[model samples]
Target chain A: MEAKLKYYLQIADNALILSHRLSEYCSKGPFLEEDLANTNVALDLIGLAESMYIEVARQENEGRTGDDIVYRRKETDFLNVILVEMPNDDFAHIMVRQFFTDVFHQQFFSELRNSKDEFLMGIAHKSIKEVLYHLKRSSEWMFRLGKGTVEAQEKAQVAINKYWKYTHEFFLENDTDSEMLKAGIGVDLSLIKKNWLAKVEEIFTMSNLTIPTNDFTIEGGKQGYHSENLGYILTEMQFLPSKYPDAIW
Target chain B: MNITALSKEELLVEFEAKINAEQKIEPLDWMPDEYRNHLIRQISQHAHSEIIGMQPEGNWITRAPSLRSKKILLAKIQDEAGHGLYLYSAAETLGVTREQYIQWLHEGKAKYSSVFNSPALNWADMGAIGWLVDGAAITNQVSLQKTSYGPYARAMVRICKEESFHQRQGYEIMWKMMEGTKDQQEMAQDALNRWWWPSLMMFGPHDSDSPRTGNAMRWKIKRETNDYLREKFINKTIPQAELIGLKIPDNNLVLLEDGTYKSGDINWDDFWKNVNGNGPCNEQRLAHHIKAHTEGAWVRESAFVSGFQK
Candidate 1:
């Protein structure tokens, strides 16, 4: 695979997997309004993934449709960060995962809007607005939960501690990043990491939460190394298309 | 003279006059205890139905055959949640808290629409639900827009608009399926067969047997009878099903000269069974609802503690 194609898939898969995770909260949200809000965020992420997947299909030029890329790929072929594919164990966990990703996406998409590739730039420009809203909502929840009762505060802390290691995967760079950056088709991850940490620290302080000092980071979802969760997600997501191959839904 | 000083008989006379004159009964206006209780029951039940209705369609969101379908399903389910919120707010105006209503639901003391007790077993079930279930709901809600309660009527007006979109998207799914391979067509037909009678039952019992119908109609809370709305749904939906070439699952269904289709008898025993919590998915639906509620207790408590509630 070409570096450019691999780069697009990496970003696209992150949105796709995370969107799938968020969509699971559709009917199961704690309240009606929260359900609607979560689904809206999920829809926005899916829209982003659709656009990126369209570009991926175009670049692949293998007669593969966007649906083919999303539904037909094996778990190992997905390039999303493992953070996105984790189960939504609780509302706090969901919000914490979202906050981490939303902060990264806010910076990443804003910078990607400056990419040399016009399509990537267009997607990034359009998506950054939605990501900003997501960031605000997640940050508000973070503060709400952190400053809430002892139970809520503890839950939020637990979620942050559990998910903290996954944040490292967001900044891990590979040859695809180097190639895309050299070609002006991607933004630098180091800058995104710096901005991400500062934002996390600032929000954590306001929420009365502490940032983890742990240095151990789990990686490899970008290289198709994933947790056990992704396989179950794909099995459910791809069931219909796989069962009735060649039939239009 | 203080409004509260009015005698019960005098207050009843004024309330009846206002209702008879087709005036909307606002939240702060004087209403009889029975009227208030009736509106609370009806509106809260509607709200709970919308919430419970999410699960069957939600079952297919992940397995939606395409991105477009997945997004549409997600949006539709989200709309159901929005409808739940609207109806819950409307119910809250009757002096019942949302927590109270939800508690009743979790306790199985409150009733939602029984149609959701049936499972959506296939991807095509999405189409059937959107077309048949929502089509039936719109028929009932269109009449509900004229209900005497002001807030409930306004909520119906907004809900009806979104429901029409849901109905169309559902029909679009069926249409696309019918145009696909032979197996796809079969799937659509099978789904319609399973959903048709249940959708008909959504209008509640027949006029003669419905206990709430008389009082509801006298109060103008229900402008049409169950039989009337069921007829209207049948008349509107049969053609849409025909256009998609899916069978109605009613062997005895016929288009009467009065332009309404007369179908075979509904399985009222099954209907009552489902309503009384004996249906295929009654346990599953309520269990899922209670689980979500119980698991979210701490979250709700936190929201309250943080002054997130008004």
Candidate 2:
């Protein structure tokens, strides 16, 4: 695939998969209003994904459509960082995961607003508008969970520990992203990652939560390797599209 | 001695002219203590209702039929929580803290809307909640926007603007299911039947039986009576039910001479029973809430420790 086409697909696939993960909280959130807010974020993510996929299809010349890109793609073809695809083991875990990803994506997309690529920049621009709210809401929860009580403090710390390993992969720059950044396609993930870490570290310190230092790190999400969670997510997400190849609903 | 006493009649020439003229009553404005208490009770209950209302619909997040549906539902639920927060803030303007209100709920002194106590059985229940429950709520909310309390009225105005989409999404679910297979249609109908009465009961007891109505109406807190909105709901919902190819659960639902659909007597006995904690899912619902509160204690503590830095 051409780099631009591949570039668009990476962004699109990440949003699509993560949105699927977020949407899982539809009826299962601790409260009704939180469910609604979370779901709105999910919709925004998916809508953003569709737009990116359309741009990707335009460049591919493979006769593929948005649906084809989203539903037809197998697990190895997906490119979302593993941080988003992780399970919502508990409400704290979910909030921490969302906080980590949203803060990172906010920086990434905010920089992409100035991209030389018109369509990619446009999508990123619109997406950052929606993402600001997610960042605000998720950041608030992280603060609350981290600072509220002893138990809440411990839970936040544990969530930070468990998910910290996956956070590194978000900034891992390969040829595709680096070349695009040079052409002003988007920001370099490595730079965005550095800023994301600094911001998150400040939050962690203030929240009275400790960041775990482990030499072991999970990689290869961008390179098509993912955790076991993505497979189940893919199974449920692809079921309808797989059954009816051209289904539009 | 039979009517007016001599001393009282001699002194009765002077009343507060502005209060008698129906001028806006500020918190510092002198009034009966009963009026303040009544406003507190009503507004606090309204605030509590918004908070607890999140349960039934929240139950369906894991099983939303589609990504679109899930997204819509989530947004709607978030609005409900925001509404609760807004109402709490409004109530605080009347001199109450949110912590006190939550404590009342924990101690079983505060009451939320009775409708939310029921379970959301399936995806269709999500449709029913949005369509009927939120439909009834909007009817009341639109009226409440004109309520006498300044802050409460403003909150209602904000809530009503965002509420328009909620009912439509719900009815859209029913529309899809009605056009879907037999099983789906039946699921929608079953949800409608089970939820119909509970939803109507949400407006509270009949006008004749409700003591708070006269005072609330006089104070402009409750813009309309229970019977009034219930009639409007029937008149509006009956046509909607026809469009969806479903029957209204009540058999005696018929158009009156004024073109209002007269519904049957609401079973207040069942209402009281449910209010007394014997509803089908009341225990289960509270249990879930308490568990979440307990389990998520650590997160709240951490948030405090973080000191709002993030």
Candidate 3:
């Protein structure tokens, strides 16, 4: 049960953190239509987080609500990957971050639909459809910006170089992952990584972009270590709930 | 359809007759330059207001008290962006490009609602903005659905539907907070205190001082006077405030025997000051907008160069 809870938290925290990052673009998109698109994507991610958190709460059976699990957790308790917590420095960086995750989720959720856990299967089934649309949108932007103009191409390359190292953390297996895999209630990370790399390579080729050749990688988010940005995100996200701990918002 | 053959006097008589009969004015229809200019200014300002309005409410999206509240706030702000697009499209029919309108906004040549110049300091301000600010906008927009221009009226029809949802969500936030702890109730009241008069100012200056009201009313462009709509909003809103156990923030607020609610005079000096670009957040709002626009320049250039113009 603890392993399953950790697995669920790992996925939920990723969605929640990334949704928080994207929500920052709510009223600040490059244009009106793009703003709406970014919000739609953010809403989808947050919705997924809500569902996963609900499942985690039910599984824990400690009378904890989804909000309790999400809003009351300390920074060291979160299990999101370091990639999702990275700052959205520009449109290029935002789209690259999303593009990397969407590709991974496309493979991860598709395999997750076959999980032995019924609840996990149900979430994966619903999430797969949303992630496919997300994949299409992010990939289209990646192609446009990568192949468009000299400046856009340069910006896209810079973002890819900065974010590529974080992609390695997606495949880093831990005890919770191994336990879920043994129980047939989680995806095989190695397989998902292989498929993710293949799809990313294909898209990069089409976009006239190249993958980073550096072997260095950043890790630790799944084990609760995170960048400084995650602390700021938590401070803001948990401010109201922390201040009035017992009040219903 | 070539009204070029008709003299200006003859065209003016026909145009006046169409407007008198409450006929819809299409983009291709023959109209005076003044009418086109009036609609452009009004419609573009409306669009810019939608864009700028996103900022105040957006200040709370990251810190909303709950997951549900966060989602609601995000969707509402997205709707504002949609409203901005719709109004910009409506303005484009008047032969001005969206680029020109955006440029004008960045240059401070175009004006949006001054109500947005105020900061949203507390979570309750979200409720107040949605309730009072959006409430006032709906009163004006409901009248705009009957505006003389066809495209503008259609856009308002779509906008008012979404805005009604925004107003309800805002009110729901206020209601929830009022029913919560004492601190929550105080926050709700404080939000009202800050947002109240600025909301009244959203109706623009009094009719006696408004120069364009005469031409706008004549052309059926403005369906109601600023003072008239402001009065209607107060009468409708005062009851809701009382029901929620919140004060109206005006000492002079009173109910007359005629069923109208009267309030004290608005701070015209402040209103004019904000309108003239001296408001508290005027520079901040414009600066943020310009920064976003400038940063996104590369993305826009890429999209255009990639043949994704549409």
Candidates' DockQ values?
0.68, 0.36, 0.71
Q: Give lDDT tens digits, candidate 1, residues A29-132.
A: 88777888999999998888888888889888999989999999998888899999989999999999999999999999999999999988998989999999
Task: Chain A only: list TM-scores of all candidates.
Answer: 0.98, 0.94, 0.98
I-RMSD for candidate 2? 4.7
Q: Tens digits of per-residue lDDT for model 2 on B1-310?
A: 5775445333322212443454445555444556668777777888777656767876665345555665577677778778877887877766778767766776678777778888788668888888999899898889888776667788889999887789888899888878876767887899999999998998888899898898677666677999898878878888898898988888877678977788887788889988987888777666665666555445444545657443
Order of the predicted models by TM-score, top scorer first: 3, 1, 2
Give the per-prediction TM-score of chain B: 0.96, 0.89, 0.97
Identify the candidate with maximal DockQ: 3
lDDT by residue for model 2 over A1-249, one digit each (tens)? 777777787787777777777766554555435656777788788778777777777777689876667667889988888888888788888889888888888998988888898887788878899989998898777667766766666776788899888888878887888788788776878779778878788877766677787856887878888889888987776664465443233
For candidate 3, lDDT tens digit of each residue in B1-310?
6545888989889998998999999999889999999998999999999999999988899999888999999989989999999999999999999989999999888999999999999999999999999999999999999999999999999999999998999999999999999989999999999999999999999999999999899999999999999999999999899998999999987789998888998889999999999999999999988988888888988987866422
Off by over 4 Å in 1: B1-4, B308-310
Mind giving the per-residue lDDT tens digits that candidate 3 earns over A1-249? 499999999999999999999998877777777888899999999999999898888888999989998899999999999999999899999999999999999999999999999998999999999999999999989888887898988898999999999999999999999999999998999999999999999999888789999989998999999999999999999999999876788
Residue B124 in model 2: shift from native, Å? 3.2
DockQ of candidate 1 against the true complex: 0.68
Mark the regions of model 3 whose C-alpha exceeds 4 Å error after superposition. Answer: B1-4, B308-310
Candidates 1 and 3, the one with greater lDDT: 3
Error of 1 at B109 (Å): 1.9
Candidate of highest lDDT: 3
